[model samples]
Target: MTQREKAKQPIEADVVVVGGGPAGINAAIAAGRLGARTVLIERYGFVGGMSTAALVYPWMTFHTVEGKQVIGGIADELVRRLQAIGASPGHVRDTVGFVNTITPYHPEVYKTLAVDMLHEAGVKLIAHSFVDSVAMEGDRIAAVRLTSKSGRLEVRGKVFVDTSGDADLAYLSGAPTLQGRDEDGRTQPMTMKFRMRGVDLAKVKQYMLDNPDEFYRKTPIDELESLPLSGVMGFFKQWNAAQLPINRDQVLFFTGPEPDEVLVNTTRVQGLDGTDVEDLTEAEHLGRKQAQQVADFMIRELPGFERASLSQVGAQIGIRETRRIVGRYTLEAADVVEGRRFDDVIARSGYPIDIHDPSGKGVAASWVKGDGAYDIPYRCLLPQRVNNLLVGGRCISTSHEALATTRLTPSCMATGQAAGAAAALAAEQGLAPGELDVRLLQEALRAEGALLV
Candidate 1:
């Protein structure tokens, strides 16, 4: 049979989401709650993209620098559910230094919660499915071509949300897109997150308190010494004489649900574009190897981890950026640093511009002055030259600098929720996503408990 002849019966929905990460999860939930027939497709067998697949623990802070909760709605609901099940411990502030917003959780627990929550919201979840192509009827996406174990199949929808993180659907639909910075077409490094078990929390905490100089913290705030493992930023110098193969500085670890468990964020594979199949494959190998090297160094050099075991590796490497769709509006660095507000704002984010060096040499973080949050306009979600489609997650339109902050988990979820609701409403009104009344969309998001600036 020909490629077209092998096609199966179309799976129809009012809204179709092409990802199962934080953004895709919330998008489907929001769409389904509006009484729209929603379907969520994922590349993996399970949900929770970076969080579960990459073993990335904790949601980045949902608050502004002023300590006000800026990101709520579906994002907050997920955290609350995880906390209720002891999968997460809510949010913690790193007063020792940059006031990092951290909410630690279990990867498995996060995956479970996401799947259950999507099901409870009445969103159909299709796992291990990938969108290979798009069928465009004029400017609108008539159907999405997916290749899975069952072979070629198509999903038809009134509206489509591209939360693929890499803008897969948007790009496949011939939408204009850009990758990395304008300088070299290079993107941020990919990381492999791992966990350490049997960690001696008491011993580690005591050592951190005693050898505060070994670690770096700007101000000594409340609960300083109690933090099991804060930022010991300069521990990397110790590894220099020993000559570890790992790139970058510092051994960053966050406390897990149990005192004896901790999540480690230290592996980085630089100069790899996440969208390229060959590059992504190479990153997965190199990232995991780096993780093993880091783990061995930990047992040999660090305290509290003397008896710790390299318990688990992530399901996949954590991707920071890839193909960013060129949307109606491109958010600039000034928008983030100056805390610019938009008339059709969808979400608020306070994360600094954290750039992981493409050379695998180092990292640079520039904070937002006054610790304020900036707005993501509704236009950013509307991919340019596309009808009945929206882009969410890290793939949204933004300058490289602004993308550093807007791509956070909470920020992605916020955008996902907004895009989903807007798509559903667009379908209900029988209008294209680009033609729908944005003010009404904002009202719908506000009703869904999202905090729009």
Candidate 2:
């Protein structure tokens, strides 16, 4: 049921973080800042994972509905850096109220910024390298083998942080993992983001500023004007009237940092496993087809996009859910919907529970109560049977429902920062990550400016 390969040429680190998404970046930075010898491995040449590779712009839910900025630390640093370069427009409300406070940014610049921060933190980065396998010693992982054009190499670490969104390392290391919903193994549909240039934002705004009733985006609330998904329903109605074979009902668009460009998030591919190579390949092909088709549809049906051209397609399809590691504690849907708080919380989450239908039709969400947030406990990051291992991103222990919230970019940054700090402390004290003092870890996090309340 599997394949195998022999590993060679060992390298070592105090902490080894797999995957270079927001989580891995923060983890590496935290460990390095703590004076730990950290190594970060990424499959892509660039650092940003879904944010860059999948073109998933706009960091979401940086604050609670009550408008308290809950996430800080390296995540804040990134936002500030992007702000300094005028590549970010700052956090604002979601037009449709699907989430709160989405900070839209330039993908390429974000990648470069992440790399610069990582390097400045003294974290060694190995790009274009994929984790092949994990070497285990009883309940602990000894090292993980990586493959690249350079050749096969094994990286030994005192502690391992798995930020792979698909939970690749957790699955490989014999940690228990679950996929999708409990009733069935069906995951949320995957989306491929594409961009269009020569967009008339003024025209779109004028249309929205006039025909407010026909558009999906309602009027700006609380004096916060987010990037608009205007003229969505009206254009879909037009698509229907014109007998266009447009399969989607929602119009998801983000205003880019650069004028005249709009990022589109409408390509949805269902019935695919993000972790399976064959399924991923099929999804990619289907995604490409849809990107072209949608670009053509937008030009014909939507205003502002009348003269728009397909400028770029994301390098990879963005799969929202895959394998979720069964960790020491599993975050449940109720915990999020009810805004559960934990004494051991290392990160605060204000995001709602968003589940995109597996059939790729639409999305359903349930928000937290009283405009407050929930806490992600340290237990969720601790994978069962892996004492020295910590899961940092979407793969951290969560039910299919809870992963919907925890998988957001902001949550990933918080979890990643926590995992890296825990790993570094564990390595320094010669203790497993699970056995490290969480109180001390919290103090360290507070000292680093993480907003945990």
Candidate 3:
């Protein structure tokens, strides 16, 4: 018939995962390896969503403040794989003192590894496809409508997972969702991360030594000479003196897989809605302008960047907050700070509540209690009113304060692995994802080396 009619024909799979970021990749791989015919759909030509597209380098805090490795499974697998290929140096101490460890990986290499692992697990990837709508059968999602270079198409699956970061699939399916903070509907500010090459680590370290009070309070001055400069989060004096137009309080940069290269994560685009195209466009423009100014300031003022040159700006702005599905259980600020444990724990994280003010000023942070991590319950992934749909990544149910920590990349991968295993198990049992036995799901994740205590 016509193109519209042709789009109605469905492509079948046991599990359908939307978004090809870290969460989606792990979800699809977990499902595929468990014998499900899994399909992964992404809007970009490559995977590694924020990692590659937004240039959010250095996966942070896979361990607790006590140096205990809390995040594992696919997240750990990805790091090990990168290390095997010499694309990453594995987990290193966080000199910035924001977290316990930061896993630095080559973003280009991550794209390749993600693709290779997905293929090895028998996952079918549909890149450059954006899902805009869904067909519902009662409370369950029957299919999702996708638009791409080839025009329109529909994907039908037994179970659906929304790892779209913004919970796009859940929103399209009419699931109840919450956006931004409770006081105001404003979300955390978006940032554009850029890279600089020819950075002199020795000079930067010496500067830190000479002006210890200018850096983060937790920065270990004595160890600077011995430890790698994995990350540095303070340049208070120079930043304040220069009076850059950017909204951030201090300079923050992370060392990389390359010795001479550093990723700058200091640009903050505040008071913008990440889901709105107009807001996103403005963020992109404003962020790039700030990036250029920041780079110039570094070259002129920062000791380590004397010869450094601006290398690359991210393909997209880094979105820290968006629409989170209102799931059966909403993770709260107390749960994170108190290190709450759940009987149905699927994932755990020790990252703190780090809220970059929506008004574009300072950050409010609170670490996990006494070097302990809090549990992420299975009910958090079960969106209310959606029968066969699951959610992973930063979009899973959580209060605005709690989102600051759960929005982290490593934790997103953990939740994703849980959702994928649950999806495959539910599909095989001919049941909705919520009806799947939490114990069995936990067992499956543990079998795959996931850490859920």
Report the C-alpha displacement of residue 98, candidate 2, in angstroms. Answer: 2.7
Ranking by lDDT: 3, 2, 1
Highest lDDT: which candidate? 3
Over the stretch 1-453, how does candidate 1's per-residue lDDT look in tens digits?
665665677989999999999999999999999989999999899988887888766678788766778899999988888889888768777533554567777777788888887888899987878898899988889999888877888899999999999999999999999998889988888889988898887776666666666665553434666554533344544556667666776777777767788778888888888988998899999998999998988888887889999999998999998999999999999888888888989888878787888776677777776548888999999998888899889899999878888888999999999999999999999998888888998898889789986
Each prediction's whole-model lDDT (CA) = 0.84, 0.85, 0.94
Q: What is the TM-score of each candidate against the true structure?
A: 0.95, 0.94, 0.98
Candidate 2 segments whose C-alpha is farther than 4 A from its true place: 1-8, 217-236, 239-247
Better of 1 and 2 by lDDT: 2
Residue 144 in candidate 3, Cα distance off native in Å: 0.5
Model 2, position 65: C-alpha lDDT score? 73
| lDDT minimum window of 10 residues, candidate 2 | 224-233
- Winner of 2 and 3 under lDDT: 3
Spell out the clash pairs found in candidate 1: none
Q: Report how far residue 237 has shifted in candidate 3, in Å.
A: 1.0
Clashes of each: 0, 0, 0
Roughly what TM-score does model 3 have, to 2 decimal places?
A: 0.98
RMSD of each: 2.5, 3.7, 1.5
Candidate 2 CA-lDDT value: 0.85
